[model samples]
Target chain A: MKKHNYSAGPCILPQEVFDKSAQAILNFNDSGLSILEISHRSKDFVAVMDEARSLALELLGLEDKGYKALFLAGGASLEFLMVPYNLMKEGGKAAYLDSGTWASGAIKEAKFFGETVVVASSKEENYNNIPKGYSVPADADYFHCTSNNTIFGTQMKEFPSLDMPIVCDMSSDIFSRVLDFSKFDIIYAGAQKNMGPAGTTLVIVKEEILGKSGRIIPSILDYEKHIKAESMYNTPAVFPVYASLLTLQWLKKLGGVAAVEKLNNAKAELLYNEIDRNPLFKGAAAVEDRSNMNATFLLNDAAHTETFDTMWKAAGISGIPGHRSVGGYRASMYNAMPIESVQVLVDVMKALEKAI
Target chain B: MKKHNYSAGPCILPQEVFDKSAQAILNFNDSGLSILEISHRSKDFVAVMDEARSLALELLGLEDKGYKALFLAGGASLEFLMVPYNLMKEGGKAAYLDSGTWASGAIKEAKFFGETVVVASSKEENYNNIPKGYSVPADADYFHCTSNNTIFGTQMKEFPSLDMPIVCDMSSDIFSRVLDFSKFDIIYAGAQKNMGPAGTTLVIVKEEILGKSGRIIPSILDYEKHIKAESMYNTPAVFPVYASLLTLQWLKKLGGVAAVEKLNNAKAELLYNEIDRNPLFKGAAAVEDRSNMNATFLLNDAAHTETFDTMWKAAGISGIPGHRSVGGYRASMYNAMPIESVQVLVDVMKALEKAI
Candidate 1:
């Protein structure tokens, strides 16, 4: 049975990506060498690295705009430390919006560098919605925010324009929707969600914002050194980067982020509309702030829980269990998740209402 | 014809690992979903992480000892920074041995944290030998060294008995030979040579050595935190870790490290003997310090280079060109490299001598 996999991260990629990447593992580019066995500096892999970097920028429509896309090891969690190490000057202050677990994690690491101010936090509300009407300090080195909260199922619809560099953690929502990517100086995403797999992170930084930190950054943590070395300062996550490239190529063939955004919007609407119309279920996040990629919802009454769960399982629907912090179900619809999967979940919900 | 691959790091792995990992990408463990599409927290993947970690310690004979094995991202280069971060106290000193380019790189990173002392250096000799008779500063936080110098084709035959904690970067020679694994506090290797691929790093650290630095380490760079998280502090390098587990299983099926050590010794002897007997070729490193994993050699006369290069290429040999700094040929025979490939290279060397 083909599962309608909705696992939050390290989730579904295009079927073509799985097929092509698997082939590369066996015989990469007809070289008769497994991609796993080739040197990172080989012409074939260098081409892979180059193309992945450029294609990332091209999809975001940030080409030749003083931006360098780097496919680095250590997922977005490591970026929490590197962001502060690269952007926070000695005794610098960084302002962060604590919207969810990951956003708070980044703020914790930032506090190690210098004064870290939480501009606003939805934590008191269990991060049920994006905090609003917050202001970043004018003198802070940079203002950081998470575009989407995977755990809370909330996404910021608007970003505040600030004089200082604006950094966004787009780990779960990058390449899913079309946004003005240039509005932020630094945009990063873990490849696990919508991009590729779990090993690599994509960091898109405007070159001008780097080298001003004044702190003595270690070479591995230094963004300037990585850019100077063209993202090969160390052996990159070779297989992940190649898999990401195949995913990006798949996205491009389907008309880039713009086309995918349309598909994603339709999927979100189909699921959200059902959640709203059904008397037994209610959305977990604020309707206005709900994420397009992940829809969190719960039964209005606990009586229907077992039947609903059994129905979804019988329908071959998997990975809809919500995070422990937010109890219920979370149907994650990344770019590769077709609307047909969302409909299956909706049908299960409808079946529950009828069977009851 | 199957090409004999000798690329340094990101080199060859067992044929079975390639096939099995590729199959996993399509439908892992008969789970109906692609491995690339499954959650890392899933039961199947958590099982992989547990098995990979335990099998690593089991093969190293470190199980039941106070050691923990972690599969991490950022490769061995990241370990260069992480080691100092988690071990060195603030305002402390570290002792290092300058054996090769990678060792020098580690030394550079350690300097960023505190005073780094070079206990001994073979750099003046172009890293063609490992220095001996050097004493580490007892008061230093830890003593760091590289067990194998991949670029210069030298391996340490003995390590000094020191009171301080000992750390070794075993990126090239790990799993290829038997060593006193418990003597070191921390052992890190990029999973490219004698392991699996390039996306993940294998770190074996003695549990007692952690959290003693008294420095506020970032969670990502904190080995203690990673150990506590069971090596899943964040999403791990899932595919690479799985492939490494497959390779480790392969090694065990062939009778573990001791058995592979015998094979490695035979391969190294087969090539080193030919390099010594062939009038046209000479070994690069000191005979006493020659590496069993990577055997670097030079043509006695540069005039025979063209013919020798042609002979090797015609014999289906690839990735033998050496580092630009050395300007010769480096045949890297990691654990997965069969002795048959070494024989083919030896035949090519003989044919080159005959043609010349």
Candidate 2:
């Protein structure tokens, strides 16, 4: 069957990006050595590393500043602990906003190393909206937030008004918009969503925020260690990093983040409008809190569930199944998801509504 | 230049493996979705995951065993920490033979989670040989060893004389030899070396060794967590895992570990013979302790370095530069390397000898 991928993460990628990436993996940058077969230190691989780092900074509008861009291993989950281990000082505290599963996971990892003050949480409201009236600690090490909740379809929408360092798990929505990165001291994301693949982690940190933690971090878990080593702290996730670099090149050639962000919103609105207009379907999260990347919804009651599922699958759309945790459907509209896929999904929704 | 890749890890791959892997990255298994874009939970992805897991067990000869195979995101460097995080009881002791860099790294991570006993250490001799005369403590939770040192070119060569549960980092030399799996409690390797790429880590662990560590492990760092979650506790390193699986398939079709081991022996022998015969080349590691995967040697005089380097590069050989920490040359002959590459290097050495 012709398939359109709507998987939440490990999600869709551009055809050009994948083609270029595959070629590189086989024989990187025409170096006659597969990206998979070269030293991370080779001049070719180093260029990949440098270009990837520079692009990340460029995407975030931090190219002129001295912020170091790193592609490290162990994903953002490792960064949860590493962030605290590097920046959380002895007797220091970090402010956290518990917006979703990933946010809570970050809280748990941070607690392992230092004290955390959860300034706001949407758990009481089932994470349908970003919490309001968060009390940021004036003396806190940093304020942490999950920029977009993939499961619940919520985004911070705007930067948290903070006087302290703001760290974010921008795992799902990193390049989806033109983010004002200066407001955040550090931003980390797994590459599965908007970046490339699932092995390397993209970290952008202000150089001045490091070296305060009293804890002795294991070398692999240290941020400065990675920055100093230029993410070749060890032989890094070479293929993933290389793939991510190709994707970045694709992003640049497609006229950068601003160009994609416009298309992304159009795709999101297409599916979201269908949900609002269709009688049988209702958006799962609050309209104001809807995620531009992942659209979550449920068939009103159980009667039309099987029908909608069958129609979408027959239309060659996949991963629109809602997370069992949320009990409905989620259409992950990452950058590579063409607007046509969303329109087809919208058509499926209308057909299901008419059938009902 | 048509480069010959001998880059210790992130080493060589079969041309066919790269071809298929590259195609899958663009469009996976004919699903019309890039491999990186698919949900790990999708049936197609699950099938890829299952096949890769099965192949790992088959390669290690663990089909009918009390074992579970997992493909994890963190490289073995992270596994160095995770092994103890999941297996070590609070204050419980583990025994480790400090063979080289990896073993020492693992030792550092294990000590953070529990008490660690260094059974023996070769730091006195810079880890040129596996330490002898180590007594395993019955009270020890597990015994750890690195199967081979990529830097020093030393391997365990035989199962360590131990009675406790055994764990090993076979990152550099896995699949280069035929070995009994009955002795190990857990075995892991970063995929960069013999398996495939650098993003994925392969683990074979007895299920019973889990649930012993009473601490709460961060979800991603927990091996037990990954095992329970079926290696998809998070978005996996899809591209590298698929490539590793393809490489394993290639190995299986080439007649499994035994046939590959014979070819590996011939490659190592050709280079080692040249080193022994040529007056210009001096091996850094003990002869008995040499690794079949990476051969470390120094030119007779530093002045001869550029001559041999130019000769090798003209012949399309690359990445034989030794690690800066131990400068000379290192010809890593991982499984993907054609023996002709080694023969060419051997011929280069002979020509250098005659020229001198």
Candidate 3:
């Protein structure tokens, strides 16, 4: 049976991505050697790394804009530490918006560097909505924000226009929507969600924003060193980068991020509309702030839980169990998730309403 | 035609591992979801992480000991920074043995934390051999060494005994040979060589040696945090970890590291004997310090380079061109390389001699 995987991360990718990646694993680029076993410095693999970095920037429409893309090894969690290590100066202050779990985690790491200020937070509301009326301190070295909250199912619709460098963690919603990507000086995402797999992280940094942090930085944690080496400072995550390239290629074929945004918006509308229209269900997040990538909803009455769970399982819908903190169902509609899958989920919800 | 792969690190893995890994990329463990598309928290993948971790300790003969194995990212380069962060005390000193490029890289990162003493260095000899008759500072926080030098083709036949902790970077030679295994306090290897691919790194650290650094460690670089999280503190390199599990299974099935060590020694002897007998070729590293995993050699006369190179290419030998720093040929014989492949390369060397 075909499985509709809505896994929050390390999540669904294009079927074509899987097929090509499998072929590469068996015999990469007709070299008769598994991609798993080739030297990363080999001409063929270097081409892969180069293309992956180029495609990541090109997809974001940040090409030729003084931005360099790096496919790094550690996930966004490492970025939490690298961001402060690279951007925060000696005795510097960084401003951040507390939006969700990941945002809070980034905040925790930032505090280790120097003074960190929370510009605004929706934590009082269990992060049900993106906080507004936040003011960034003019003296901050940088203003950081999480573009989307996967756990809370909320996404910032508008980013603050700050004179300081702007950084965004777009881990779950990087290529799923169209945005003025150049507005942010540094944008990073773990590849598992919309891009490819779990091993690599995509970091697109405007070169101008680096080297300002006077604090001595370790070579591995320094953005400038990675950019200078073209993300080959050390051995990179080869298979993940190649898989990400395949995914980026798939996105380009689908008419880039703009076209995918439309498909994604449609998928979100289909699922969100069902959650709102159905008497049995209520969306968990604030209606206006709901994430287009992940739609979190809960049954209006607790008695219908078992029925809905069984129905989704029988329909071959997988990984929709909401995060433990949210206590609901989260249908993650990343770029690769088909609207047909969303429809199947909605049909299951509809069946639950009738059966109840 | 079958090709012999001798690329150092991100080198050859078993053919069965390739087949199994490719199949998992399509559908993992009959779960009807690509391994790349599944959550790390899922029961299936959690099982994979557990088994890989357990197998690592089991194969190292350290399961019952107070040690933990973590599959981390950022390769051994990150660990260079991490080792000092987690072990070196505030304003304290750490001792290092400079054997090759990677060992020097580690020493560079160690210098960032506190006083780093190079207890012994073979750099003056162009890293042609491991240095001997030098002593580590008794009061240093810990002592560090590389078990094998891929570029220089030298392996440490002995380790220093000290009251302080001992850390080994076994990136190129882990699982290729048998060692006491419990002599070191910490061991790390980039999985690309004998384990799996380039994405994940294997870290085996004794439980008792952590949290003494007195330095505030970032969560990502903190080994204790990773160990406490059971190697899932963040999204691990899913595909690499899974592939590593496959390789470990292969090693265990083939009677584990001890059995593979005998085969590796035989392979090294066959190639080294030819290098010694062939009047045209000369081994790069000192005879007593030659590595079993990577054997670096050169043509006695530079004029024979083109002919030998052409002959090896014709014989379907790949990735044996030495690192640019050491301008010669390096034949890397990782665990998965067949003895038959070594015979093929030996035949090519003999052919080169006859043609010249």
Candidate 4:
């Protein structure tokens, strides 16, 4: 069966990246050293690092500016704490926009460090919509937001224009769209989603935000520490970062972020359109705030859950089960997700509707 | 020219693991979904998590004891802070045996969290030997030690047989020898050295040692938090851990740690013997402390450095350059090094000796 992956995160990567990355791991750039074992300091490996950093800057339009692109070892979960450690000071505050599980997690991490005033929260609406009309804290260190909620299938169409720095966890929808890089101070993502692989976390941070925290941050958790060390504070997850770099190169060759966003939009539209028209399936999140990355829906009758799962699995659709938090069905449409995969998922929905 | 991989860390992997790992990243475990893209919660991936944990236990001879193995996202460098965070309490002093660079790093991190007493240090001797006659603190929270020094080839042949919780940073020497699990409260290592890859850090901690620390650790850095959550406190570095699991399975199939150790010893013996015999090369570390993993050596004549590097590189010998800290040459004969590779280095040294 040609399995279509809809599993949320540690998610899919471009096929080209996989092929190239694997080849490198076996024999890195024909150096006869497997990339998995090469020294990060070697000329060949350093080139990989340099190119990865360059590609990140190119993707985000930060290549010319002084923005620093770093590939960190820990996943975004580690970043949740690292962010507050770098930015928030004693009695220092940050405004948070809570939309879903991940957003709440970031907020939870921040409270331990200092004050985090939630500027907007969509929990009142069960996280089916983005909260609006809350004022960004002028005195806050920065405004933190999750760009896309992986489980809830809701997204921020535009970042709030804030005078304070902007820290966005774009883990789910990073490469899914085109955006101006100037609006944000820090943009981070786990590579498993819309990048290349798991293990490495991508941090695009403006240099000005760091060194503000009076607390002595541990070397690994400090962005300025990594930035100064060129992300070689200790050995990084080399293979994953290399894989991510390859994926970035592929993304650039396919016309950078602009082309990726268009394909993502097309894929999401096909599935969401089917859900909107079908009587058996109902789109869960608000229409305007609905993610073009993850499409979540519920069956009209709850008994159809098993049937839906069985049908999808047999049809070679994998990872379509909704998160336990929002239980029904969710088809995550990441960048590596093909239009054909989404089409098959849509076809399965149609087949189910006819049978019902 | 076939590149001889001598680049340390992210250096080389068994070719078989590389091929399969790459294919899975494209489409995991024949699941037709990219391994990078799968949900860490899925049954297929959960098995990977479980198998890796079990195999780690088996490799360390720790299965019967209630030892919990976890695949953490942060590299060993982060474990520097995490160790003290999970074990140290206010006014609780830990006895630390500083062997080399990494041991010093661990000590630095420990100081931030609690009082850390340097029981003994070989820094006075340029870290060429593991300190002797050191007393392990019975009242101390834990006795921290680094098992192997990568840059400086040295190892702790026999740990102090003290009735104290032994916490070891086995980053470079894990799986290089068979360990008696009962002695240590925790054994942690970065995967790049003797394991599968670089991103994932393996941690094996006794169930009882956790929750003893009074400090409120950040969730991601807490061992107890990870154990309770079954190492799923956050999404792990799935692909790297999965690859490491496959390598573990390979290691077990090749007769577990006991079997691999013989091979490791033979490789070390061949190189150390050659260094001792050759007038051109002199071993750097103390005879008692020489590492069976990374072999540090210096040429008697500094001018012959280029000649040696050229000879080795031409013969496809790699990663023989000494680290910057000890600038001569280092031949890291890790777990994956074929004995033939070491034999070739011996032959090269012999040829150079005859010409001189």
**Top candidate when judged by DockQ against the true structure:** 3
Encode model 2's per-residue lDDT on A151-184: one tens digit a residue: 9988778776777778999999998899778888
Model 2: lDDT equals: 0.85
Give model 2's DockQ, 2 decimals: 0.66
DockQ of each: 0.88, 0.66, 0.90, 0.69
lDDT of 1 by residue, A191-279 (tens): 99989988999999999999899888999989999999999999998999999999999999999999999999999999999999999
lDDT of 4: 0.84
Ten-residue segment with the worst summed lDDT in candidate 1 chain B?
B347-356
lDDT of 1 by residue, B1-356 (tens): 88899999799999999999999999999989988989999999999999999999999999999999999999899999999999999999999999999999999999999999999999999999999999888899999999999999999999888898999999999888888999999999999898888899999999998889999999899998899999999999899999999999999999999999999999999999999999998999999999999999999899988888888898889999999878799999999999999999999988887876
DockQ-sorted candidate list, best first? 3, 1, 4, 2
Q: Which wins on DockQ, candidate 1 or candidate 2? A: 1
* Candidate 4 local lDDT, B50-169, one digit each (tens): 999998998888997979999997778888888888888777888899999999988988888778999999898889888988787688888889999988899988887767678999
TM-score of each: 0.99, 0.95, 0.99, 0.97
The lDDT ranking, best first, is: 1, 3, 2, 4
Ten contiguous residues with the weakest lDDT in model 4 chain A: A25-34
Which of 2 and 3 is ahead in TM-score?
3
The ten-residue window of minimal lDDT in model 3 chain B covers B211-220
Q: Where does candidate 2 clash, by residue pair? A: A11-B37, A322-A328, A322-A329, B10-B192
